[model samples]
Target chain A: MIWDWAFAFEILPVLARAAIVSIEATLIGFALAASLGLVLAVVRIAVPWTGWTISVLVELIRSTPLLIQIFFLYFVFPKFGVVLDAFTAGVLAIGIHYAAYCSEVYRAGFDNIHRGQWEASIALNLSSWTTFRDIIIPQAIPPIVPALGNYLVALFKETPLLSAIAVMELMQTAKIIGSDTFRYTEPMTLVGLFFLAMSLVSAVLIRSLERLLNRRTMR
Target chain B: MGIRTLVTLLIVALGVIAALATQEAYSLFLPGLLQGAVLTIEIAILGSLLAIVMGVLAALARMYGPAPLRWLATVYVEIFRGTSALVQLFWLFFVLPQFGVTLNAFLVAVLALGLNVGAYGSEVVRGAIQSVARGQWEACTALNMSRPQMLRRIILPQAFVAMIPPWGNLFIELLKSTALVSLITLSDLAFKAQQMNQNTFKTIPIFTLVLLMYLAMSLVVTIGMRLLERRASLGLARGKAA
Candidate 1:
């Protein structure tokens, strides 16, 4: 009974514009997490004494809420003289939170690579960097593509939380429209529809990427 | 000393120094944070109980119930799992008012979280049930057990052991999610941290104290879950074999 097609059509362009912010956060955030996670995974494996320290840090990041992490970076960090813009802080918190998960995925992939591969690289006189880049990382990456993709979808879904810090993402835009027009049914539903569409598309993309990765590995 | 131990000590030392320097801020804010922690725990406990119950029912409906019920369950899971929990809360808090069914903020938050987590938990439940070997299903059928009796007696016991670790992960996740309820204006831990920060303008100490409080709660949950998991897994092998 509350549905309004006119208002739905009216507010959609604004929502679409805001969806770009959400998409940007997801892409940049996922990039930071994926690269940082690879580094953490490698450091955890290569550096003996540092592994425990890295693990503890990762565990701390993993176990706490991302919102608190964002709040820390956005509100508290400036007090300690470490200032960042709200957008940057949101992306960083999401990146670091998911990096903990990604590192675990990479670690499992690292563990799965045959021990002989490391020994073979050593016998061939490859440097540690070469062994990691050429042997360990290549083998470690494919099995993890699916997991990384899942985090991508997850990160996309989590973008709305950035709205908490006033980032003007899709959800925030929808809320603003709803408050202004007092027509909640349209804008909020549109936001959910936008998210549903994005997730479904990502699910399809991940499935194909997984198939491609499996084929590449088989090859 | 190992680099790990040294680093940990250094981190701990920094925390001690910060606490000492901001002793007044620490004293004034700690009580507020603790009170907020109680509310956080309450939301988490109630939300998780709802989620687990909804999860069990949904998983059963999707995996074992008749066709129309399966479709209904699938739609429920998809709509919930596919969206953000924040938006779900907004829908309940904002949109539902348009339909003349306004829930109070606390109830709205709990419903949103419970439904969102329940969607994820249903997947866990479904996967756990399916992981109970196919042969077990056949064996139950051979024993002439009624469907309800078989599920209650045979399937659930085996499924429960497989369910524990993931449930633990979900439990921690659900607890952390209590932080989000603050968005709906619940006076929970995260909200309290922000409120104190706004009031005192001593953002660093208040949030630092808040972060540690959350981390300590998480550690407790992790430890409690491990204990529960250990107990649940006891004799699981023997049970599965029989």
Candidate 2:
């Protein structure tokens, strides 16, 4: 038997539990990315002097592989006295890495807003904070939601890389199962299916969220 | 650049050089890492070529082939695209032997990464082909060209230009993914770093060097893609000017 249904069923519970860790990592990492990315994009725009440094930092992060970045966080930072657990280090690396990409998406969104809108906010005597919070961000976010959602899915896929750091995510759990039982097919295939199902679900959710935003903005 | 930016860059350069100047560690680490980098580059290049071929065929079949081929292409793209690359590599490396088929680690690495990226590349190909303009297709038909001839002589040439930038992005992505091949026991860059770190406990220097090497390779991919894009577009510019 190339694939044993019984063995697959037996291992389903363990893989599913590990999947929660993967999902938590994705959600937390994405939250950090979403917020931190916005801040980075805003800082670049608002602080003209910081633009060069920020852009260079963004490009450096974007160009490198996430696996090494995670390793750097997990291993190197300890030498500098900033120790982080495997899970935290992995999530931070993924977050900061994706934040660079997400910032670009946000920048494009911000760019799409007409200059007159900023001029109008100034004319109305709105504080800069009010202008951004009540006006610019609301306008900027809708157009870029789908792009941000793509990153969400991308980040989810990246959680498997965290296993490289021994974070015990779904892929790591599956591999451990394989090593223990000496049966690779069922566990590996199940992990693949789990990723496919989750990504497909996220894609659908992103589409509906885009439509929802479009409707709200239209009204 | 501003003086501050220049200073910052200078400091970083000095730091990197100072770190690498540790003669004993440099001698120990560089050779193994470089050897691994060679294998990494080999996998990346071969994988990219495979990805391009798979992408073009899948995109063409999905767009124009018979129903069966189209369905097969669709399935191939989705399966490859949806799963994480690690799972796919493991399936090929570990599970295939279960069914009495075994491939070398290097072969599995290239096949898995290539097919995975090929799935993403197919979408880029499909989009570029679609963007080639309706009139171009109509003109090809009006000239009584066969389907293959129409695509070969007309559609693909124009589409190739659009494809270059996205294909560059995918190629860089493929290069990064080659790092995952190390997990299957290939002595690629990431695997080499981990192996050395475990042995020497020189985590900072080793991982930093690995990160910089990857960044350097990706930059090469980025710059190469830009030059290709510029060259590809020059013919269109000439035709318009003429």
TM-score of chain A of each: 0.96, 0.96
Cα shift from native, residue A86, model 2 (Å): 1.1
Query: What TM-score does the first chain of candidate 1 have?
Result: 0.96
Candidate 1 local lDDT, A162-214, one digit each (tens): 98899999988888887787788888988998888888888899999999988
Model 1: pairs clashing at backbone N, Cα or C within 3 Å = none
What does chain B score (TM) in every candidate?
Answer: 0.89, 0.91
- Residues A8-57, candidate 2, lDDT per residue (tens digit)? 99999999999999999999999999999999999888788999889889
Runs in model 2 with CA error above 4 Å? A215-219, B1-27
lDDT of 1 by residue, B90-201 (tens): 8899889888998999888778889889999999999998998999899999999999999999889889989887887888888888898898889999999988877878
Q: Which one wins on DockQ? A: 1
Interface RMSD of 1: 1.1
lDDT of 2 by residue, B57-80 (tens): 999999999999999999999889
